[model samples]
Target: MRQPSSSAPPPAESLDAVQAALGAEHAAIWVYGLVSAFLPEQFEAPVGEGTTAHRARRDTTERLLADAGQTPRPPEPAYVAPQPVTDQASALAVLVVAESDTAVAWRAVLERTDDKALRTSALEALTGAAVRATRWRRAAGETPAARAFPGQPA
Candidate 1:
């Protein structure tokens, strides 16, 4: 059986963590696309915002994967969503959870990396996911989803 990773300082200059972050970026792009379809036609503003965010993430991660000499894995045909999203309320819920998951994966890169630039990139990714999560939560009349991140709250 595989052992779990610890908080020990990561191996030097390995791009593995960054590669894993790219995979997460891929999944998030897929999720955002799926959720966008659930927005009402009158909510063009939110739909546009969501589409832009996902596209930027997908494009940037694809470039990072290429520049790092890694091939980004394509997302699977279907993913097991955390829950069913049959309406606006449920769709916002999915968006919130999916963004949180994306943040968690990007945070892993920050934990597992030594490259300064990669760490900064991971931080940016985390911030963006968090912001999107907050926006969706507000749209759904839910509390801000931000919480103690990278570690449990004290």
Candidate 2:
């Protein structure tokens, strides 16, 4: 039998945490574009709001990383959606996933950081993601639209 590797887990340092958040923000922004494409015409307002929110968060995360002397990860020119998003239902599903994933990244940052301001920011990000995910779930007609713990895996 092959032995398992014994490398140490990656450290949860501030710079690394911020970079992870930045990556999540980038992904969220990109996914919002995909979401907008398949959303119904009536959902233009929500899609626009989601896109603007994600962009703002991405910019803030990049600034935070740069201020800490860390290079922020850039967004991919394009991303493959986890599922087919050819209809409104699938687009809402993808939006829920994107928000949930972003929440998880922010939660990780919250777990790793002791700084008060960073903790506050992480909390806000997590809460915002949870709210967005819930809205998307409701729009998708999914049951139990809200999770007790937003970032933790189901």
Local error of candidate 1 at residue 34 (angstroms): 1.9
Model 1 Cα lDDT, one tens digit per residue, 35-65:
7678787666866776677668767777766
> Residue 42's C-alpha lDDT in candidate 1?
67
* Top of the candidates by lDDT: 2
Please write out the lDDT profile of model 2 over residues 1-154, one tens digit for every residue. Answer: 4432643223449668778888888988888877776777888998888888888888888877755545789987878889988888888888988999999999988888877788898899999999989998988889999998999755
TM-score of each: 0.77, 0.89
How many steric clashes does model 1 contain?
0
* Segments of candidate 2 deviating more than 4 angstroms: 1-12
What is the Å distance of residue 150 in model 1 from its true position? 6.8
